[model samples]
Target chain A: MDVRTRNNVVVTGREDGPALLLAHGFGCDQNLWRLVTPILAERFRVVLFDYVGSGRSDLTAWRPQRYSRLDGYAEDVLEICRALDLRDVVFVGHSVSAMVGVLATIAEPDRFAKLVLVTPSPRYVDDGDYRGGFSQADIDELLESLESNYLGWSAAMAPVIMGNPDRPELGRELQNAFCRTDPAIARVFARTTFLADNRADLPKVPVPTLAIECAQDVIAPPEVGRYVCDQIPGCRLVTLDATGHCPQLSAPEATAEAIAGFVES
Target chain B: MSGLEQDAEDLYENAPCGYVSTLPDGTIIRINGTLLTWLGYTRDDLVGRRRFADLLTVGGRIYHETHYAPLLAMQGSISGIALELRAADGAKLPVLVSSTVKDTKVIRTVVFDARDRRTYEQELLRARRQAERLAGTLQQTLLPPSLADVPGLRIASHYHPASTDQVGGDFYDLFPLADDRWAFFLGDVSGKGAAAAVVTSLTRYTMRASAVHNPDPVAVLRDLNAVLNREYAGADRRFATVLTGLLVPDGDGFAVTMATGGHPPALLISADGSAEYQHIPGGQLVGPLRDAHFASIDLRLRPGDTLLLYTDGLTEARTAHGRYNEQALREYVLTRELTTAPALVEELTRLLAGFGEGLDDDTALLALSVPPA
Candidate 1:
């Protein structure tokens, strides 16, 4: 399989500048980084991609045996990096993507220069003292009859999904998904992300890392951010004055600036 | 429209549906009486105090932040999203929501009660599953538990249902007639589900009863055609492509005499594995027509020779370029050198699996061979 086509890899910005590969979290695709991409692209070579089961990436390539684990998603990240031959890269991951980035960086430490984890949680369900912010029941509720049915994903999103103005060919592309999400795939991804235990993998990070948290995030609270920073050696923490799990969407400018500051430093 | 326009404020505040307006970031900015009454929340409690997402249940909140919010920003509108909200008393209220971006900073939304609809949908889903289960059970009862053990011939059969949820139209059976003669038949009904299952049941039984009455292949098919025509001769008449045959041990091999009613011909593989289709020219469809012509072919299955009978589902399955025609199946059988009955059926079953989604129709295959004795 063509790795670039399988992941829907989109490369933009200065070719000579350092590479910054952005990976999105669950419940979305590569479109999650659209708001912040333009800002980060000015000085860095940016890469954006959708996970196999999410967004416009080929749904045919997704299998429950492969994508039912975070390791499967981590493989997607590593494959994209290898496909582009990207080296000394700045990796930015949002929500669950942060854990995915951590696994990828651990697998191929030489490919990455810096790791920027945006509103990430190594584990979502609460364990004893380590609060992942959600109960086991809450994750179950999200998985049960997951709400986003791509066939029923509303006619309003058609224009954006059919032929996005920014890239008209995306509509013509196979499995064209801008914002629409398949519920079956979403359920698997949700299970993989929420039930994962990547806290053990955090301490093994081999690069400069930044854990950016939101001031008031229900998904990943400030303490979880602090815990992430304290776990990884020499990792920095920054909390943007933003709410919601997705800072890239809720607070794009601050999210972009924080990422740029870390990447350029 | 004019009357409603005259009382626009009253209608907006007290319409059958709840209407609210929120900021681009989902902060509740405006609310109406009906919605406040539904949630038992005052303007002071919701507006400027909580965002639209904050009012939703935990799962709904996650769905909103991840999917609803991003799509709304990208598309400027969203519709008919099912979610639940916590009423002031903490009871969950199921609702269908549609929101449109009224301006750069404002998103107007309408929320409709979906309590009854959700219950109905769940009931429908449960009932559908039950029906499918019953159909599967009924389908199994229509086929023989195992192909009857003919003393001199080796036999294997495979059945594939396109979907597990609904009963398919394809069926096959093999049994013995009196006087050391064995009877076998394979056929496909036009439609699927419980209705086609009825036809399948009738066809299987009718073929059995007809063959017992007269083991002659053409006579048996003619009797079936007459029974089907007499029973289902209405405007929306049903039809079936049936193949019935009798096997007789002929000293060193089995003499196979089979008749077809608008069905694909059986493929005969010689001992050396040269495969070709048996031509049954001008076999008319069963049912509808008062009198339908049946075609018969007589062949001998010598040592190491096999005969394969299948429904159109096999020949009509789609390939990347077009339908998988009979010629392809012949070439596949010849190249693979499939001469044994069990080997032919098993390999063909594997081929059917390769069709995947393209195999939309049910398929039935029955292979019989005279092994070296």
Candidate 2:
């Protein structure tokens, strides 16, 4: 399948404008950028896409071996860049996507001009001395949450399932799309995202980066934001007044301005 | 305050569920009397002194931060979240929490006592896990625990299941017949799970019975075909592809008589390292049609020569280029140049494992050969 179609790519704004790619975190899709994309699109060529297993992306292509590690998602980002022939791009990644952007930049630094990491953490599970704001026990609980919360997800996804004329044959297909991910895929992705330790990859980011830390994000605490900023060479740390893990949804203007300032400067 | 304010306070305090309002960081701003009573805490012990997360166990606290807080922040509301709240006397209180963002600063939560619901969900989960375990055990019991030990011959087999969640259709067995003769068959019944399991057991038993009644390879398959065709004649028709054989002493090695019923041809690897398929053509699937055809072939197994039988799962596996069909299997066999039955089966098992997620169907394999003296 075409990479664009596989990732459910959407492009808007000026064709010749410098490209600004937006990548969302786990439990979300490209739609997380709905508020921030409009403002960024006014001045830059905005590109948005879901990960292969999330949103409208093809679920059939979700191979357990491929998505077993974060590198598969990093490969997808590189593919998107090559498919669009985007160069010197500004990548704005939120939550787990922040690490994905880190991986992509490490893979092809020439393709990215700068990076904006919002509420980002290089690692979630804490190491011996480094506090990533969560422990191994915490991630396990989160996985349990993912498993048990499917009831609400299935109920919300009922419309998509009912929209099909044939119920029996398409039942499995609808179950996969209800939470924008198949339950099996979600479990793997959750494990991959939360248990990831990308601290070693921090130094390899060849492009300048902006670490947009929310003031009150429990997921990625301030210490983590500082550690990420300290690890990347010439990485700027911007503490947004926003109080949630999703600064884009809760504080879009600040998120947009941070990206704009970094790109223009 | 209005004159109706006294009743409003009474209702808030004595509501069916506990109500607690907290800051975005879970600092308790105000909590009703019902919740304080449930947790065995006074209003003074909570108000301005503790956070909502402080009342939860360590696991619950972690869940609150990692999932509950993030979801509430992202989705604006999260309802019916199961959690355990720690009480003043070190007791655990199971509760269902529903929280909504009142504004940017405040989070309003309603908590319901869920002891009975927790017990019920545990019972259901336990029952489901038990059923799956039982299904797995039942499927294992149907297959032979060990292949028959025949003198002057080597044997090996393996079964690959696509899913542990359900029983697969593939089956194989080797058992001694009367008068120093051994009977063996490898087949795949239609469908999966308990139903396929039933048909596979039936097919295995019928093959054994037919071999005892008359050990002719052709006659054995004919008997199986008649039994299946008669039993599954109506709607929900069942069918199978089988390769049945009898092994008897031929000097130092064994003479083999094999029959096929809509199954793939068996592979023969010679002592000289040449491998080829012994295709028994014109064989029709057993069970669906009354006139199902069975064809037989006779072959001599020289010392260091091996015979291999497998289901379609090995041949029909998907690959990056295309299907790994019969031609690919033939090429694979030729390159291996296996000398013994165990060696051939072991090598094939490794190759199949390399297929990883691509091998989406159940596969069964059996190999029989004579040892070089």
Candidate 3:
């Protein structure tokens, strides 16, 4: 498979400079990195891609069983690396992809140099004394809401999501085009994102990592951020003065600066 | 000012839809009186004290941050997002909200009450689920749970349902006849749902009754065609395609006599590993015409030979290579070198599954073979 087309891989920025793989998380596509790319592009080569079932990525390549777990997403990241033959790469991941990056680096340690986890969470639902912020019931309620949202908005075309990528011209006419996702595939991604328990895998990360948490994010709270930073050896922490789960969109310049600073340092 | 028109302040405060303006960080800087009344909150209680997301339920908050907020940021505006907000008494208020950025990305959001829409959608979903369940049960009743085990022959059959909400029009059955001969028929009705099922059930019983009386392949099809044409001759003319046959026991094999009425050609796999389709010429459809010519063909299924009958769903499947038509199926049968009836049925069943989203219709398969001597 041509991983570029499969993952909708887009490469930009200084070509000769070091490569930075920016992986967007659940809910949005690689367009989430639009604001940050211009800043990061000045010094580093920026690479953006949508996960297989998200955005312009080939939806036909998506298989439920393979993508139900985080391992499947990690394979997509690793495959893109091999396809581009990228080495000593700086892997930047957001939301659930932060854990995906950890898994990817652990699989191919020699290929990646550093890791930057944005609004990262190793787990969303709490277990034992762990303060993952939300409970199992909360996650269940979220899933139910997600289901209803699909029915309300995209239910008409939900049945035809397979093998049908929205035309580029059609995306131009729709206001919510960038976040256009197949409802069923998005549900699987949400299940994989919100219910995943990657706390055990954090310490397994090999390279120096930067845990960029938001000072006020309900999805990935300060506790989860500190937990991830504390777990991984040589992992540092940076809490942005931001709200919500996506700092790149909320505070684009600040986000870009942090990414560039970390990569250069 | 005229008595017919209201001032801007009155219009903004008492509009049908709720409007709230927020700062870049979602602080509720301005809210209309209509929304304030709906949520049972006063201006002092909400403005500058809460963010737009704070008024939402926890799940809605997650959705807002994950989907709604990012979309608004990327697109400069987002509309018709379904979310629930918590009222003062903790009752959930379902609403559809549209937001756009203006003046340094301060969010301007409009919320519409969606109680009736949500209720209607839930009812529609419930009705859909009930219809799917009914279709599933009805389809099960149409098919025989187990084929009758005939002596000296291996018989395997499989039914692949293309949808859960609507029953397929295709059906098949195998049963006994006089003199210990077995009679079997496969047919595809041209309609769907209960109407098609009625025609399908009628065709199956008529074929069986006709064969029991005459036991001739051509006669059975002719009777079915006449019965359907007579019963549904008006505006709702229902038609069907069938391949009905009788299996007469021969020396170490079965002499299969079959007739086709516009149905797809059935493939015959010989004992020597060769495969070919049975083409009975001049066979028209089973219904609609005043008089249709039905043709019959005879085949001797020797030991280790198999005969496969399937609906057009198999041939019409869209695959990676191309449309999986009859030629592809025949090539698949020959090249795969499948030896027995059960094995071929199982492999074809797997093939149907491999078609995945490409298989667009309900399919039925029936394979019969004489045990290897």
Best by lDDT: 3
Which digits, one per residue and each the tens of the lDDT, describe model 3 over residues A138-182?
899888877766323353322121212344334333523476677
lDDT by residue (B1-373, candidate 3, tens digit) is: 5865658899899999999999877889999999999899999999999989989987888878887888788767766667888999999889888888996778999999989978987898889889999998998888888887889999998889888898989999999998989999887999778999998889888987998999998999889988999999999999998888999999999999999999999999988989999998988998989799999999899998999999999999998888899998999899887778899998898788767679988899999999889
Superposed model 1: Cα runs more than 4 Å off: A14-19, A41-45, A81-90, A145-177, B1-15, B102-104, B142-166, B172-187, B205-238, B242-373
Q: Which stretches of candidate 2 lie over 4 Å from their true place?
A: A136-179, B1-6, B22-29, B40-77, B86-92, B100-107, B141-196, B208-218, B226-373
Error of 3 at B331 (Å): 8.8
Question: Which clashing pairs does model 3 show?
Answer: none
Cα lDDT tens digits, model 1, B160-230, are 99887888899898999999999999989989888888888888888889899999988888888898888
lDDT of 2 by residue, A1-265 (tens): 7999989999997788889999987766787788788898888999999888887886666777888788999898999999999999998888989999999999888899999898889898889999998778867766775676422232333332333434533544533432354567767787788889999999889999999998877778899999999999999999988765778876889889988888889
Model 3's CAPRI class is acceptable
| Off by more than 4 A, model 3 | A1-4, A13-17, A38-46, A147-153, A156-176, B1-6, B146-164, B173-186, B207-220, B243-259, B266-280, B295-373
- Report the C-alpha displacement of residue A38, candidate 2, in angstroms: 2.2
* Chain A: TM-score in each model: 0.88, 0.89, 0.91
What would the per-residue lDDT of candidate 1 be over residues A196-220, giving only the tens digit for each residue? 9999999999999999998877778
DockQ of all predictions against the true structure, Cα-based: 0.26, 0.08, 0.33
Give the CA lDDT, 0 to 100, for residue B207 in model 1: 86
Estimate, for each residue in B1-373, the C-alpha lDDT of model 2 and write its tens digit: 6776669889899898999998865679899999999999999999888888889865566456544665566567766667889999989898878888976669899999989977786687678778778877977877899989999999999998887668889999999998999999999999998888889999988998889999998898889989998888889799999999999999989999999999999999899888889999888898988877788989999998999999999999988878889889888888877888889898888778767577999999999989986
Please identify which of the two predictions, 2 or 3, would achieve the higher TM-score against the true structure: 3
